[model samples]
Target: MTLSNPADGRDDPYLWLEEIDGERAVAWVDAQNTRTDGFLVDESYQRDFDAVLKILDADDRIPFVGKSGDYLYNFWKDAEHPRGLWRRTTLESYRKDKPDWDVLLDIDALNKAEGISWAFAGAARSPDKTRALVSLSFNGTDAIEVREFDIATKSFVTDGFVIPKAKTQVSWVDDNTLLVGSAQTPDDSTEAGYTRTVKRWTRGTPLTAAETVFEVEKQDVAAWFGVNRRPGHEGLMFWRALDFTRSQIFVERKHGPHAGQRLQLELPEEISVGAEASDLLISPKQDWTVGDLTIPAGGLAVIDLASFLSGARDFDIVFKPTPERALQSWAETRHGIVLELLDNVRGRLSLLRRSEAGWRETPLPGLPDNATISAQNFGGEDDPKLGEDVLFTITGFTRPTTTALWNGRSAPEKLKSAPRNFDPEGIEVQQRHAVAEDGTKIPYFLIGKNLSMATAPRPTILYGYGGFEVSLTPSYMAIAGKLWLEHGHAYAIANIRGGGEFGPSWHLASRKNTKHVAHDDFAAVARDLANSGVTTATKLACHGGSNGGLLVGNMLTRYPNLFGAIWCSVPLLDMARYTKLLAGQSWIAEYGDPEIPDEWAYLQKFSPYHLAKAGQNYPPILITTNRTDDRVHPGHARKMVARLQELGCPAWFNETVAGGHSGAVDNSKQAQSQALGYAFLRRTIAK
Candidate 1:
């Protein structure tokens, strides 16, 4: 088959599908959905859906909370409350089996009262915590409408601050003041459809009266602003995100002739900034060399604010990355810094503090090995006593999540544990390595009921998301455990390049022109699974979403024979026109600019849309997306499926009217989507 270039995507047959809500395009989607349901929806599918929903709405599930002034905030969704309930509880009550929750807002009630589908995105609390700027998303998209809410009264303020929906960021500067990053006009947004301007909005004033404080180039990714009201580091901060991995930091001058003016920080664009009491935290995404001192990439360093502002290159290096170790995240507590480190893709917790001589680092013990540990709330910002207590969650492939708390003096205490959703008596989890085409040992986790493969290869699903420096860590897949693993099927996660599993170097190794390295790495894992007898090409399927959707899309076009089916959701398939679709322009730094001829030459090689050819025996695929997805336009999925069908391939497309880039707004929608994919996989490969 001779392949024809998209020629900048102008000459494409299914280009009409790009009209996301067009009458003809929607009619096509409805037809496709009906056709998909005609075959996939059955007793087994319903059973799978119910089982997944049960896990999602389980009463015994851990209620993760974020620490506020006097309460721990949690947004909960259950069978009864599909929209969710924004509630809070005291730490004392939260430690119990059934915490006494005070519901501040009921989303279902709000949606019913307003006659609209509103999803509670989050709430940004005021400095005093008596008020909040609540964000509500329409059908769970990234864009949100911000409205002021009086927490004490538990209602939206009658004449309070309200910002109409768009890709916006809101942070409380004081009880009556807010620092907002949003597009005042359509022209104020970047090509990626994100806020390019920052404004200071005060209470009792029209939004148009808000003062513009900061702005960035229209070609930049976005502009951001915030006020740090921490105990000692109270000031205004601004950031200009040049791209995914590069940003410029600026601070408002406080006590000089330049007071009230923004001063750009003398730091590398690749390094991130944060405040730690009177100290400044800097984590370099790339190696930083300053005045004969060098801070390695992925290392954490801190210096006192006074010295840093007064031109000091000396920094207290607390953490450094190694070949197998990387700093995942860190938090500031009243007395110390809590570090979440990843050692060979496994979670490790540590604490750093200033001692008599200098800084000291200590490993946090009593953690479950081989499990992923994430800090839920590092309390102590408000009260020094609460700082001694830190909340975290632990989970793995087979183990359900357990939310734990670590006191300053002792081992972490398990506060709540999620009920086991699936039987794991015979399940086993193994961390294995698959050598990539370049001889790089790619790490992967294999979970299954049978691992030896002494008898026959089992039905397997390999999942991967290899972009944006995002690390794929292990988690308890409750739905997969009940839907796939309980039936003796196998699941594998490939920690390929273009991910931060091994830190910045690992991700940068495959970014831009070398992005194909990630696809090659994923294919290597699939081939290894087949060769190792864990699974065969005839029974193995691949799954990925968003960027992962792009990952498996490549697997389908580049190595179609390596697997039996593909499950892609909310994908970016049309690379040539990606920059013009929703948030695709923001990813130019990672995937390279397709508009550039030289870059497109390499990008076209990996573009699944352009690579798809007729007369090829491509495996069956179920491509799903959402009409309301403000990020990664749904056009990618719609166009790909149309082209595939035209080429006589086994392609199925499902476009949900609601949801966003995630493709499911709530649990019911999530369950239906999962069941559809699982059913499709079972029909095409599991048998």
Candidate 2:
């Protein structure tokens, strides 16, 4: 089969590669895998693979647990149980060095018994906690089969709820009723291949006979259903995600004179909603005006749920955004809410409680500052004893992660800590600034043993992802620490404008028609590293995956003279056809619709597949992806490599058969894929 570029009406020679499982494509992939193995996997490569795998499979690694009734549940995987074991233990036992865990499910044993490869996706427990809806993904794809399991028997319930694999979403309304949405074809799904409608399914009834509760437009992203069973605030909720950054919320009355009636919320599409006790929490991405009052963008405000539903316009602003400080996330406890804030790219935590007067805010005490802090609603919100439990994880570039719990009163108590996976002895982390063409100062974190160029420059890897409003903060680089940093090389994370480091405005400044500003910011950082003499162009390597893959793809094609090697993984390279592939349609709000002539004019400028030329001085690049990556189609990587190779440029390709968009299923596979990328960097730039 042959395909042609819609933009220029030119025949596309590598278009057949887009046939995911076609015999010709499979043969080509097998040959490419063998060739990549011959080029990368040597004695030295084995050493790199072993080091990464050991760290991944280490027994002493911290086991993170979440509360569910009487047990703290955890899913564990190691060399012994490569597929993993779902287990649980008591809080007292979890506090001990060696917890006495009770195994609930053995994935490897189940796979062997069924003669199939299935990865444990996750489990959603019922409110009673006696049963759970277990999701298993076949071959590591996003599509999953959900089965009901009994906690006591530790087995799937006979004749219980079972959903065949598709992009399924399940939420339990009670033990016998569920709000389900599943799609297996375009007729039942949105343009992005996600469930387009939600239905009410009762026990013992065929799913096809379930009552339709809500439906969304085929052009919209998707519709999701949720149940809010918070004491007196019980109701059914539905939300339509119009795009990545816009949504409309709805609430259905479960009990009352208005039972069975759904009410569309009076809210801006850009505003997000949450609930705690009897109060309604809202955060607007754009400034919102209610009556004569205005709440600035990125501010957190609250109003009584009863009053809000009754058309009351009284709202109390809890947290207002500053130029440097913005609300990152928040979690609810019994008596208060824990706020995660970002101050100039650093993490900060605050606690807010209700008083007779109004809301009172205080700084959370005894937690590390200048690090990434994630808080979750631990111990179910309704638990009588552990209702106020908030679990927090704290870590930095060199700091090993530590889990702590705050009981809504005292300082957080450290529960468990991770062992030092890599040697951090002579290393230092520094935050540097790069001045872009628009005079924007981009902040980046540089980690290295030494940052001097007095004698000679050192090899370095610069990484970035500048879209989707995703913030790239400080993180413990265990794999890189073992393979790259331990070798005395440097690593830097670029906090460019397209990220949420500075909140919504930061992201909006560099997206859509102005997306080139993000690539410009990344190039500015690359130049800053060289101008500072930290590394020369020939010794610098750039790496990014997914959306970040597109970042380095631009660096490879648009700024080839600045880097020695590029590692792009699971990327969206062929912008012209991206929207038509898998879930790519959902991201049109981010990249613009190429079907529109005006949009295509600008999109082509950033498309790496179209930018390749025969005589251009392109640097060596390794494009890697997974065959089962149903998110960003592998055709992006396949076609780009073919185009570059045909143009006589140095390019290599490697793809694994399993492992979704992340490109790995198990730790061993993850280590192998990672080792291949690091080996390519070592071979090309780390002389």
Best-fitting candidate, scored by lDDT: 1
- How many pairs in model 2 have backbone atoms within 3 A of each other, for residues 3 or more apart or on separate chains, i.e. clashes? 0
| Model 2 per-residue lDDT tens digits across residues 461-508 | 999999988999887889899888888999989999888898888888
Give TM per candidate: 0.97, 0.97
> C-alpha displacement of 155 in model 1, angstroms?
1.4
- The segments of candidate 2 whose C-alpha lies over 4 angstroms from its true place after superposition are 1-10, 253-260, 383-386, 452-455
Segments of candidate 1 deviating more than 4 angstroms: 1-8, 253-261, 383-386
The digit string of per-residue lDDT tens for model 1 on 10-51 reads 688887888888999999999999999997999999999999
lDDT of 2: 0.86
